[model samples]
Target: MISSDFDSDGFVDIAGLDSTGRYLLVYFGKGANQFHGLTRYWLITKSDKIYSADLFKKFIPNLISLNKLSGKIEIYSFVNRKLNRNLDISVGYYPENLMFDDFTNSRTKEIICYGKNFGGISLITFQNEDYKIQKIDSENTYANVTPIFLNSDEYLDLAGISLKDQELHIFTNRNLRFSKSTIKKFTDRIAHLASSDFNDDNFKDICLISNSTNELIILYGNGLGGFPTAASFDLQYNADEIIIQDFTKDNLTDILFLDNASKNIFIKILKENHEWNSSIPLTKFNNLISFCLYRTRSQIGILCSEAFERNIFSIVNSSLALEKNIFTLSSNPTSIEVLKNTDEVINEICWIDKLDNNFCILKRNEFNTPERIYRFKLLRQFDSYVINKTLENQLDIVFFSLGKNYFDFVNFNLSDQSISRKTLTIYGAIDKILFFPTDHDTPNVAALNQRGNSNYITVTNPFKINPIIIDEPLVSSSVSNYFFDSVERILFYMQPHQVDTIIEFKSKKFNPTYSQGETKNHFRAEIKKGSQVITHAMDLGDTKKFDILNFFSSKGDGYLLTSFYQTDGYLPDSKEDEIILHDKSKIKAVKNDFSKTNEFYIYNENSQSVESLLSLKKGKRILTKKIKEDKEIREFTINLLPRERRELIYLRNNSPFIYLENF
Candidate 1:
């Protein structure tokens, strides 16, 4: 069965290939549980199985039909309320399953088939305005085939269970020619196959369910990318199909299986000690297929359904000790209204730069010179030299080390606002120190050794608190911005561009939480180069300032529509808080304190949304006050600062506030 807005009415309709009756069935959905039988068209006289897939990835539904008698396969597109014939090819064997994918990076998707008498596998591709059927050099029958990128190559490869040989084969696709297939005799008589990063080692592993033997086989992968052998576990005695999921919420993949003999569901959990334990037992009144990776909003879990059972089970696990039955779907729950995701409001876009070069500070006049504009200055100084601060006197023991020929400690009593300095011997000049959590210490301690012009340094017991020597770099090499995608393990670095080693480093961890009060803040900017996705990245800025208005000037000549964020903290979602620009195609970033005196447009005075340079020069009356002298009150009026605030009292406060007259 497949679904789409067939008439383009913005209403989804359902279509299915009635294999038993050999009819193309269409059901028009008026939404809200209302569906009417639209029409039916005769498909084929002798039908084995009718398959529907997005063969061309048009997002429009397409159908593939195979004849049981002649083993003839036909491809059709839905048009004019009938199957429009596109391509037809005959396979010598009756194919049971089919997949539409591009294995050779040829951009054109090929129809891959696995079935009886098909001799391993068959690939049907369209070329020269004609369809052609080709066979990979192999002689066997595969139960199921899954395409995976098991290597660093751009093309996709295949993995399947060769039924005749009773072995698992990983086919590395080599261009449009023949593939290099490595057949591993792991388990016997494999029935079902699935490929995922089961162990979460950043590499995909192959899982197989054996027919003759009731065993679940896991082709555990190495981080370097190869599943050399199989790790077998005893499943239910009659388990037929399986899937790998984190059913236990351990971040480690667990196994779920369906029993062929009875309508029973079993889960084999991978334990921390490299063993499998059978999870809570569940029995259904009908048959089930192990599939459906479900997501309810941001929360993700498993969804499973049985044949005769009129309900779909939604299982959510917080940990191994507890589980929640989150939702129960109706007899045949197809789709739900999902909240379309907009770009998430920008969070803390901090400049975590070690260099204190660009810091803007605003110093406005406190007097009632409402006509005068605010002035800002840039001072070069290292910000956030203090790691942690506390009001309690007992928290005074935390010290920062300035390693000279001897170790100098600057201890502070934050409540008393006093500091005491002491000197003891260590190494050279200390660069960066971090206070990370440790089980050995009551409170975390500063961990670092002297790092001056050295690429790496080993920091042993700093004041003997959390004692360990870690030889890590003080920072990524002169890194201005480094964006790491935890999902893809791709590290993109923006340096001097002279470095020329952008994609060399492998990111160890992502956004690791720093100690309390410490920030591992990152900025984001799009950096796209061809097909490579380096869009989400932000380098640290000078830590001396808490606020920064960051922007990436487009190297291209065009005005950009972007999002604006204030780095002070969390901000509200407003349409007005967007990137505003004039007709200029280029962004001029002057290293001046212009943003320090950034002004907001006076909203109610006029409906205009911004105070551009033109509006600021007009000098409108912003503040009004009446002074009483000799029993005669006189009204005094003054202009806004660069067209900023209207009230004199609020302008004197330096922060933003509203004037409510006499109230």
Candidate 2:
């Protein structure tokens, strides 16, 4: 059976050979589970199977039929419910099966088939308006052949099972010719062969079922035309057919088989340790010739074709529950449905080929899960997601709050003057939030919000009392904005405002405790002039006297002298260039240090005076003084310089501080 949009009407149509193999049955799809009546075309009486291809690369697809007895292949162009013979070629060997694949990566479908009775494999390709056949000789006749990507190459290789020799052969494609790459002899005769990325290693692996030993042998490919790993599992039943796919949707390739005796379907999922889980048996299927997997809106299902009935099975919770028969064909019906079930149910198109020049299409409207548990595991729910440790061993799950257009704003009361308030109404819903832990009680949060299809992210002062809003908009949901590296505490997100795209944010371990006070003794130190220890009182309008210190007679080096009045300790021989004092509060810097630069000044401001009460020049050093205080405020740093004008700044008592620097 073959399916395509034959009329280019966006609906799938089907065509197949009748029981006698002489007549071609085509049915046009009318959609909504209906098909047009029989459109029959007389062809060679001994035709075996029918295949369809888009030979002209147009929307309309054409049909190809193979005659094994006559060793002839014919291509028919189906237009307006009519068949026109376009080409006929005599392919010498009696090819049993046909596979259409782009062997050369040329984007054109090439016909590949293996001949019967020691006849080698042949490749039929169209070139220069003629069908060309390239036969590759084989020492052992293959029972079945299929094209597989044995290596990470552009061309497709061939894998065949030789039942007579009890061997599996892999032929590598090189310059449109196949060369024997690997031929492994098996102790038991292989029944079926299937290939997939079973280990999720990006390399395609091969799985074969041994009919005699009832064992499923797996040859793990190395992506270099070699199987470095091999394993076998006992089926415990005579397995006739095999398929490898992600049946459970767990991103793991599972093994499925049809029992030869009872014709029941058995499946086993591959675990991460390369071990098979417990084997599960689905409901029995009678006279099952071949089966394929189909997907519905909610779950994945199976479609099996038998002698007289086409059975549809839904996989629910790991069990295959048989659905009601979708089609009951005549005694000698040759029905065909769209075998590619990758699309949704509404897109499915099916047609059955009745032997007596009759064809019918099935309208599948019902589905049921099996009595056993077959589950569909959900891998993700959001457009994207990320996990971060907001607290120690605690997770603050933040994802795209879908359909939510608002967020709750909460503010914690830190003093008696401020009351705790929660506001439920806030516009521009938060699409995503990222928590960046810092050395404080509060974390640096990066928030994302959307307004009128425009996304904006706050990199600084995010989720604060008055959150700082950046003017520029961020990338949309379709583009990747940031890459958060939890291991290295780095976030590489999109920052369009950066000149060099400096989007990396390296974080530190979150510290939630405030800075504690120390019990160290406090002393007063003065920067004296002319190498003489003389403390000059800092009063209002002392700038004229302070400027005269630069005219010292010797131009002598200045020194900082420490004096302790309570204990009578004096630093007479000390040559300390800078004096540092730490009050009960955290003061980051006082004078010019590496944090600022060399040759900077500090001005002591008094509320009563227009000019600074005292201004002193400090060279290449920072000083911290202990001026005991009781208020808890965020640590802040102030930058001041000399010969440069300074601005008047006011700080309210017991309020949080903002860092200010005058460069």
Candidate 3:
């Protein structure tokens, strides 16, 4: 990945990787000087199982060959691992914009380079093996953004919106043939064209937004023949750029747009019938430049910012109504992603905050509420960034460029909440970072950098250590159990043997709190049985993010059997190891199967534990065994618990067990 540190205090601009798994950092010169090319190309390598960094004092001589050119120069390079060589190429005069498209086949490796200068798009292809350079096409009036490759073919496609004419051009193949008939003239500059299945026809359509128009346009047909018929709708707010995503889990395309002048956010929900149902203002701030969206199981997360501060929010009920503000902090957020299936919570959001010069995490619940979790500050600001969640929930590896001399490889554990950092030096200013996982089980991280003199490439093995596993579990206990008079409900907490315990309750009150309690309910003894492994906790309150009763019962045995529930009073914190039961007749016993093949359960009179129990894989039948005169029910439940501290078990036979306790 290539990133630019526009806010960096020093002259460092870009960072990337070299051929030998090393990092290359590049710094821009302060003044217009011929000698003001790449100041340094540092090399980072691994030896004796440790990454070492050093300046590449020898690579500086490569500048001697890139002496003089007629126009201001812009350089971009990529490493062809198959050919074992780096190709350095440049565009002159108008070099502010650049795009790269990689076309790799069995016999040939090619990269199509396009950029805008005083002229239009300058197109060139670099052949990897032979190091051959060929100029295919150039237009004097068209400026181009990064070219996106649509498929795997010898031909590559790129789109450029003409700065002078306000026309969209589609360049086909490396031959650079412009589809003139397909070019559409727009009233404003086309900021971006995103691909999505807007009609659910299994064909990806293009959603285009313009910098000067508040209307978002959708082209319905697949890209195989360009956009078919286009439709435009006036947005509630002006949109500088728009993004299409399935934010509401409705399987229909939704829209997120950013206002260039006001720094406000707007979301448009697409209904199941492919119509824009609602357009609502999400958030507003000053100097907002960009925004990105990430989807979890139950909610949509928005990562956005003003000029200097970044904020995140989620939509509740898929309603487009702004319900809760998740995270608001002082930093510029560059990127965000949701880590999947790593915890009991729906997902974890990770972002790079520039103001704090650190990375941060926002814990998201199934109901869309978010909590500030963890933050880690780095020694130097990042230039560009990319992150990956590895297999088996192993670790979240973040590859970011630092300063003009190195790339930082950092690893974060989602389960245990730990972080490790390493730095690599390269031969140029790192511009982009990409990860290529090989079939042989090893993966290499590729970094692209621009040295003032010539372009350089770097590659590094990011795997430094074996995956760490946590064997401990998080366990907690609660005592006070009471029901509120207004809601006519009861509340309790369950302490599972070795699993993370839960606080649960059922109430008619849509929103419940301690103030609503009519009387104090108490339990004599509640013992916390396992480890305290969770570093952070999020109390989602009565908001939709948390299903209090359901969340508690989904883990193991139903709350009534394993937890202390009281409808009339509160338990003192002093009691331990004993159960004080009142109104036992109010608790009903219902037979239900706990088998995976026939998992079903029934709720008792006025008790919501059935909802929680049903959420678990197995039903509540295991807790319904007949009580014998000699054998106590409590002893049998305790005996059924797993012997290992963090053992996985299934309620039914033959089914694999998942991690029951948090670690």
- How should the candidates be ordered by TM-score, best one leading? 2, 1, 3
Error of 2 at 462 (Å): 30
**Against the true structure, what is every candidate's RMSD?**
26.6, 29.6, 24.8
Q: TM-scores of the models, in the given order?
A: 0.42, 0.46, 0.36
Q: Write the per-residue lDDT of candidate 3 for residues 1-663, one digit (tens) a residue.
A: 122322222221222233232334343323111112333343322111111111122111111011113332222232221111133344454344333334332233233333344455554443333344444445445544434343344555565566767676665554444443335878777666666677887655666676566567777755464666778876656666666666544467777777656566666776556777546555456765434443333334554433454222233222111233423321244444434343353455555665467776655444434433567787677635666666544454545663365666777665676777777666656555655454534345655455553333345665545221111111112222222221222222222333244222322232222223332223233334331211111122333221122111222232222322233223222111211122222132121112211122222322222211222112222232211121111110101111221111101111111101111
Backbone atom clashes (below 3 Å) for every candidate: 8, 20, 42
Q: How many backbone clashes are present in model 2?
A: 20
Which regions of candidate 3 are displaced past 4 Å? 1-88, 103-118, 129-137, 144-154, 174-182, 222-226, 241-255, 277-285, 288-663
Model 1 misplaced stretches (Cα beyond 4 Å): 1-19, 26-39, 80-82, 181-183, 223-225, 228-230, 242-257, 265-283, 286-663
Candidate 2 worst ten-residue window by lDDT:
544-553
Give lDDT: candidate 2, residue 41: 78
307-383 per-residue lDDT for model 1 (tens digits): 55533344432001111122111111111111111121111011112122321111112221111111111122222
Best by lDDT: 2
lDDT score of model 2? 0.48
lDDT of each prediction vs. the true structure? 0.44, 0.48, 0.40
Candidate no. 3 TM-score: 0.36
Of candidate 3, the 10-residue stretch with the lowest lDDT total is 650-659
Model 3: lDDT equals 0.40
Positional deviation of residue 393's Cα in model 3 after best superposition, in angstroms: 19
